[model samples]
Target: MNSLAALLDWYATLTPASLDRIAQFYAADAHFRDPFNDVHGVPAIATVFRHMFAHTEAPRFEIAERIEQGEQAFVTWTFHFGLRGRAYAVAGGSHLRFGADGRVIMHRDYWDAAEELWQQLPVLGPPVRWLRKRFRAA
Candidate 1:
């Protein structure tokens, strides 16, 4: 299968036990950045996944859309998990640049932490919603 196909499959089926296989999709010096993390290298990337598993319960990703052109691909996905005894689903997308060997060299995730994450919290949700309304264009 093609690298993008394989990557989508990997993410869809990702589990804490399978994190060890992250190296297969990322180059040794890969750079990965997301709303909450900016890290380089495969080991550091693994740490991010590890932290995810440590913090959330049954965190999994479902790929919603994919667009590929040459060595670059963009994917939209939904991340589902439980935190603080509550279930949450965060919608996000990622831009991936592949190396000559088909390993990901750069992976940047796009997500709004304020709207997608903090807004899900009980105390912060009200303030965030109020602020969004206050700043919204007329």
Candidate 2:
């Protein structure tokens, strides 16, 4: 299989026990950034996932769409998880650059915390909804 397919498959099946294999997919000095975290290296990247495992229940990612050309790729995905028995799914995308060795050298994720996460909360939801409506043309 191609490296991109292999990487996506690994992410689809990622579990705490499989974190040790992070080095196989990411370069030694890879950089990663997302809405809440910006980190470097495979170890730091693994720590982010470790924290996710600790804070959320049954967290998993599903790839929805992908595009690749040359050394760069972008993928849209949905992160599914549960919090206090409530299930949630957040849609987002990532831009990745691969190294000559086929491992990812840079990864950046794009998602809105307010719209995707905080807007799900009781207090934050109302205000977020209000602000969105406040800006809408209608």
Candidate 3:
């Protein structure tokens, strides 16, 4: 399979709802990283995912763009979720290294956790958001 297509297909199996499927896309000793986590092994990765899902709702992974060269691929994505019935969205990027097994052995993600999640909290939401806009405007 094309590395890009395989990477995306593997990512599609990883979501708040289908977390168990993540194991199928990773090696036993896979290394996984994201905005808030850096871990080794599929079980550890699953634990991190569980923690995230427990605290959020409707967390879906949408692949927005991708680039591939041989055994590696890069993907830009938007993670959608809701809190207190209000919807929120965050854009993130992931860099993936694939193994000959066609599974991801290493995955790293880059994004602003504070803005994507913490800033969306009830009391801090407005202030953080305002500050972000203010900073961007200044």
Per-model TM values vs. the true structure: 0.96, 0.94, 0.79
User: CA lDDT of each candidate?
Assistant: 0.93, 0.92, 0.80
- What lDDT tens digits, residue by residue, belong to model 1 across residues 60-109? 99999999999999999999999989999999999999999999999999
Which of the two candidates, 2 or 3, achieves a greater TM-score against the reference? Answer: 2
Candidate 1 ranges with C-alpha deviation above 4 Å: none
Q: Please give, for residues 1-138, the per-residue lDDT of candidate 2 as tens digits.
A: 228888999899999998889999999999999999999999899999999999999999999999999998999999999988889899999999999999999999999887898889777889998888899898
- Candidate 1 global Cα RMSD: 1.2
Error of 2 at 101 (Å): 0.4
The deviation in Å at residue 126 for candidate 3 is 5.0
Candidate 3 per-residue lDDT, tens place, 1-138, comes to 335675576555566667777766788899998867889999899998788678777766788888888878889998887766888888989888888877888999999977877787888878888888888955
Please tell me which predicted candidate would have the highest lDDT against the true structure.
1
Q: For candidate 1, which ten residues in a row score worst on lDDT?
A: 1-10
Better of 1 and 3 by lDDT: 1
What TM-score number comes out for model 3?
A: 0.79
Q: Tell me the TM-score of model 1.
A: 0.96
lDDT score for candidate 2 against the true structure? 0.92
